[model samples]
Target: MNIIEDLRSRGLINQMTDDEGLEQHLNKEQVALYCGFDPTADSLHIGHLLPILMLKRFQEAGHRPIALVGGGTGLIGDPSGRSEERQLNEESVVQGWVSNIEDQLSKFIDFTDDDKGAKVVNNYDWLSQMSVIDLLRDVGKYFSVNYMLAKDSVESRIENGISYTEFTYMLLQSLDFLRLNQKENVTLQIGGSDQWGNITAGLELIRRTSQEGEDIKAYGLTVPLITKADGSKFGKTAGGAIWLDEKKTSPYEFYQFWVNADDRDVLKFLKSFTFLPLEEIEELKKEVEERPEQRTAQRRLAEEMTKMVHGEEALNQAKRITHALFKGDVKQLTKDEVEVGFKDVPTYKLEESEKGLVDLLVEASISSSKRQAREDIQNGAIYINDERQQDLKYVINADDQIDEAFTIIRRGKKKYFLIRHM
Candidate 1:
């Protein structure tokens, strides 16, 4: 399929300046396109996934991608999604973020030096050198106050207040487009829906900067914001943003997040997030309708995303933890797997001893009293290391420990606690 059609199937295209023209331009030649990311944080989160994947889609379609890091624009924040002004970051801090974000961006695209391979560039190279006089005379002259005020990014912020620094972010972004067009031969800009104004501003800069009647055609496209069916934001869980960096969000945690995808949303995410073949995804969709109890879609989504982000070994570990927990075979887990599998479960550290399960249950508050603990054990409702403990005086022996450091306690069907041997 054509790149636009493919993006449309993935629900990636939000707005494009001219669909037919851009498609014609794309099919005619391998043109250069760009997407700009600001160094707002040290790592890009799952919310940043669409754009990164979109760039990859273009490169695979035989186009060149220029991943623009806004090292310069990051200092003056864009007020697209915010209700209030952003506290500007110090240059030194933003520079660190730039380094981190650059490294993260490098992983997703083809960056090998070759024809049509991706290129990473910093706007800081040009934006830091331009003076106030030139910025005003060249870029500021093209944008009118009325036009800037009408943009959704500025219109929403005008009531609360907007700083001149942020107000001129359009001009600064426009200048980046102009510079890229001049230097890199970049002819198109892509971004989130909120950046429609800025992307158009860049196209306008290219238009006005060139002499009249000069051929300086450029284009802009944007992707819609990801949203959940129940009106919550996407890529958010009780924990927080799902980051691309495994250190911030472990591979196990990331895998579990997708494994818990809502029945309503899993199929949509499989298409939008994975490059799985359409036929394969459609087959998985049939499984969702036929036997959702199996959660086939959720499993595939989790496996695809976890493998994509964390590699095969980490994905295997996550699956091993999951399978062990499901099969009531906690003894199969290693120390690291136990740590990740039960990271959010209640934890109580204990001095190593052969503590009887009944007394330990009462002491750890797993049972309300000794009578309750004995009743729970006798009723076979308590589990030590996932093995049923019907004996009233089962002891926590070294054999009960998974990997000699931790014990798993499961009460009834779902409640779990991890006891660490200190």
Candidate 2:
């Protein structure tokens, strides 16, 4: 299938300017396309994955993908999809964020300096070079206040109010497109749905700035915003946004996020996020219907996502943690796996070499008192590392520790506490 058809099959094309012309343009030669990611945060979240993956998809189709970091415009902030003005960051902070985002983008797209090699550029390189007078006389002259106000990004913010800095963000972004087109021969710009207005504005600037009869072919495309079947926002959990950085969101947490995807949303996620062929995804769809209890589809999605973001070893560790937790057999897990798996669980430190199970439980706050701890042991309500320990005199020693570092204690079926051996 053609690249457009492949994107269509995956339901990725949300809004494309001149679909026919753009498809023809992509087919003619190695199209150089670009997408802009603003450094609003230190790490890109799962919310940013669609566009980044879109760039990867294009690259796989023999196109050159330019990952543009909005180091300049990020300082101003885009008002699209916002209720209030964004808090501006220090130049040094934004630059640091820019470098971090560039590194994250490099992991997803190859930039090996080949025909289809990707490129990472920062708008700061050009936007910082232009003077306010030059911007007004050159790019700003083409966009009237009326024209800017009509844009949804500005129009929606009229009641709440918009800043002059943010209001003019489109001009800065448009200048980026025009500059890329002039310098890099980039013809297409893709982003999330919120960027349509800014993207079209860029195309407008490109058209106006081109000399007569130049036959400008710049285009804009936006991917739809991801939503959950339950109506809550996607990429969000009780812990907060699911970041691509493992430090921000551990591989186990990331794996669990996708593994716990709602049954209603799993198929759509597979299509949008995975490079798996349609045939394989179709088979998984059947599995979801026939054996929902197995959660085969969800597991596949988790494996693919974890392996892609954190690599094979991390994925294996995540799976090991997940399996050990599920089976209530955490004895085989390494110390690192235990740490990643039970990261959010309450923990207590064992100060002594050996302590009675009841004393340990009371000391760790796992039980309200020694009396309760003995009662819990007698009633078969407590377990040490998934092993039922009804012996009130049983001592939690080095044998109870996994990797000689931590012990898993369960008060009941689900409530768990981590015990760190000193």
Candidate 3:
């Protein structure tokens, strides 16, 4: 299938300006397109995956992709989906975030200095030097206050009150588009559905700024905001946003997050996120109905996404922990894998080595008292390292450790506690 048809099949295209023109333009030539990411945080999360993958899709279709980091505009936050004004970060802080985001972005898009290769541009390069007069003369000339106020982003914030700083964000982003179109010959801008107004504003700037007879017909496209069928937002867990940085969120947790995708949402996620063929996605959809218990679709999505983001080694490690946990055998997991697997489980520190299991339980408050601890042990309710602890006087020693670092203690089918040999 063609590029547009492929996108349509996967439901990636939410809103595209001049669909016919874009289709023809994409078919006729390798159009240069750009997408901007604001540095709101030091690391990009799973919520940011759509656009990154979209860029890859475009690049694979033989188009030049430009990943623009909003270092300049990030200094002033975008109010695209916010009710209140954001607290401004220091210039240094934002710069650090910009660097970190740039690094994270590199993992998604291949950057090349060649003509067809992807380009990474920072809006801060030129935006930081422009004065207020430059903004008025160049950008403000095109955007009327009425047009800005009518936008969904601004209109929503008007009641609660948005700052003049944030109110001018569309113009800033539009300027980024217009400038990129002029310098890099980028004719298309893409972002999330929330950025439709800002994108169209950029197209308007391109239209007004171009001289007569100049072929500066720019276009904008957006992807729908991902929503869960269960009425929750995607990329969120109890721990918070699922970050791309393994340090912030371990590979195992990231793998588990995708592995547990809602049955209703998994097919859509597979279509939109994976580079897997349509036939394969359809087959997975069938499996979701035929054998939902297998979670075949969820497994594919997890493998593809985990390997794509965290790489092959991390993906294997995540799978090892997952399989080990399922089989109730975690002895094979390394120290690092143990940390990632049990990071969120309840943990207790033992001051002394080779302590009695009863004493350890009472000291860690896993049981209310020594009497309860013995009762739990003798009653076969407690387990150490997945083996039932029937002896009340069983000792938790260095030998009980998984990697000489920690021991897994289980009270029942659902409860787990990690005791460290500190």
Candidate 4:
């Protein structure tokens, strides 16, 4: 199937400007399309994946994908989906985020110099050079105040008092499209549904500034804003946003996020996020219908996402941690895996080399008291490294530690505590 058809099948196409014409244009030649990512944070998160993957989809279809890091526009934050103005960051901070985001985007898009190889561009290069007078004379003149006000982005903010800096964000974005179209022969700009106004504004700028009968063919497309069936936000957990950077969110946690996808959302996530064949996904859909308790589809989704974002090694490590935890065989995990798997569990630092298992349980609050600890052990309710330790006098020695760093203590089936051997 063609790129547009594939995207539509995945429910990735939310809105397309002239869908018929854009499809024809894509089929005719190697169209260079771009999606701009504003460096609002030092790392891109799960929310940023759709647009980045959309670019990849086009590149796979023999088109050039441009990953535009909005070094210039990030400094002047886009107010497309906010209720209030965004706090502008220092130029140095934004530049650092720009570099970090570029590194993250590199993981997904192939930048090898070939016909369909992707290109990464920073708009700060040209936007920084243009003077205010030049912007007013060349780009601003083409946009009337009424025309700007009529846009959803501006209209929504009129009541909230948008700053002139933010109000003109559309114009700055428009300049990007026009500049790329002229210099790089870019014909399409893609973003999330929230960016529809800005994308179309850019298209308008390209048309207005073009020579009469120049055949300006710029178009815009947007992926839908992801929502959960439960009405909770996507890309969020109680901990916070699921970041792409492994340092921010470990591969284990990232894997868990997709692995725990809601029954209603897992199929949709599989379609949009993974490049798995549609036929394979259909089979998985049947698996979901026949036996969701197995969570086969969720596991596949997690494996695909974790492997794509983190390497195969990290994915293996995550799976090891997951399996070990589920099987209550955490002793099988390495020191690093232990740390990741039990990161949120209650923990106690053991300064002493060893201690009686009963006393350790009392000290770590795993049981209510010494009396309770002894009862739990005798009742076969207390476990050390998943091994039932009924001996009240049993000591938690170095052998109990996983890699001489941590000991997993379980009072029952699921409640776990971590003992750190200092």
lDDT (10s digit) by residue, model 2, range 9-100: 99998999999999999999999999999999999999999999999999999899999999999999999999899999999999999999
Report the Cα lDDT for residue 382, model 1: 95
Instruction: Please identify model 4 stretches exceeding 4 Å from their true place.
Output: 113-116
CA-RMSD of model 2:
1.2
Over 302-329, each residue of candidate 1 has an lDDT whose tens digit, in order, gives 9999998788999999899889988888
Report the candidate with higher lDDT, 2 versus 3.
2
Best by TM-score: 3
Q: At residue 273, give the lDDT of candidate 4.
A: 93
Could you give candidate 3's per-residue lDDT for residues 290-330 as a string of tens digits? Answer: 99999999999999999999999999999999998999888
Report clash pairs, candidate 3. Answer: none
Which 10 successive residues of model 2 have the least lDDT summed? 110-119
* Clash count for each candidate, listed in order shown: 0, 0, 0, 0
lDDT of each: 0.89, 0.93, 0.91, 0.92
TM-scores, all candidates, are: 0.95, 0.98, 0.98, 0.97
Over 4 Å off, model 3: none
Task: Assess candidate 1 and give its lDDT.
Answer: 0.89
Q: Rank the candidates by lDDT, best first.
A: 2, 4, 3, 1
**Which number leads on lDDT?**
2
lDDT of 4 by residue, 1-422 (tens): 89999999999999999989999999888899999999999999999999999988888888899999999999998989888999999999999999999999999998877544688999999999999999999999999999999888889999979999999999999999999898888999999999999999999999888899788799999999999999999999999999999999999999999999998999899999999998999999999999999999999999999999999999999999989988878878989889888889999999999899888888899998999988999999988899888898899898898988999998888899999999
Runs of candidate 1 exceeding 4 Å displacement: 114-116
What are the runs in model 2 whose C-alpha is more than 4 Å off? 114-116
